[model samples]
Target: MEEIALHILDLVQNCVEAGASEVSIAITECRRDNLLTVKISDNGRGMDQATLAAVTDPFFTTRSTRKVGLGIPLLKAAAEQCNGSFTIESSEGKGTQVVASFALDHIDRAPLGSMADTLAAVFAVHHVDVHYRHEVDGKVFMLDSKEIRQLCGDELMHPRVIVWLRAYIEEHEKQVGGEQ
Candidate 1:
């Protein structure tokens, strides 16, 4: 993918397909170390060893909706191109965790595109709880829908909150990203 956010979207979609009710996404950008890492964990029906091993294969997919699987394979290629790595671990009854890391300064490293927009898109539509934490250098930005629900009460789904989140994400994208 051209942008890391698109990769994130595809990975999270896998979580949803696995019957996840809770997903956690963490992005840590260490500019000084020239590293960018993304970790996505989900409390969903996980995979067997065989399935996990084949997850990176373009020809292997558990879904009947499509004949090919390019998400994980494409992501793997992207990371490797940047002198990075991709790893996935899971337990059948427990959950799954996917980690992808890239060399920040590598010429082939893909852009970590509007990440805030990616988070907002995942949160607004899923209805399920997601814990999102972004760390740029040492600074952190956190969004917990459960917390929002607690504060907003029955109005948790209010259109205003969604709009506010979208605006907040867009406005402070650079700040949250440590670009400024």
Candidate 2:
């Protein structure tokens, strides 16, 4: 993934495909510590220990439609190369959690990317509930699909809703990310 947001999207997609009904994504940037952390958790049919052990292998995939799973491997490599760490924990019939940390200001670290767009894209398609939290320095921004659903009903996939969502998220991204 070119951007960290894309990685988040890919991981969220994986969660959806794994029968997840709920997903959580958290991005924290600690400039003082020079650390950027991304944690994604999903309530889905998780992998067994054996599958989890092999997930880091790019060529080892459970999907029959594809021969390789590059998302996890690529993300792992991206973090490791940036003097960071990556870990994934899963339990069969439970859920999965992936955490990756990177050197925040590392020259090789990819940009965080357009989170608003990425999230809007997800909302425009999948109906899975998502809780997204992003923090930069000490500022924070949060979005909960369940809350939005309660207000807008289940028709959140509509174009207008998605447009509004994108703008809303974008504005918050700017504010919380300190772009303003």
Candidate achieving the largest TM-score: 2
Query: In model 2, how large is the Cα lDDT of residue 116?
Result: 94
Q: How do the predictions measure up, each by TM-score?
A: 0.91, 0.97
Choose the strongest candidate by lDDT: 2
Give the per-residue lDDT of model 1 (tens digit) for 75-141.
Answer: 8899888999999999997999999999998998878887767777776677667888888989888
Can you tell me which runs of candidate 2 are displaced by over 4 Å? 178-180
Q: In model 2, state the lDDT of residue 49.
A: 85
Which digits, one per residue and each the tens of the lDDT, describe model 2 over residues 108-150? 9999999998999999999799999999999999999999999
TM-score of 2: 0.97
lDDT of 1 at 69: 88
Return model 2's CA RMSD, one decimal: 1.3
Error of 1 at 119 (Å): 1.5
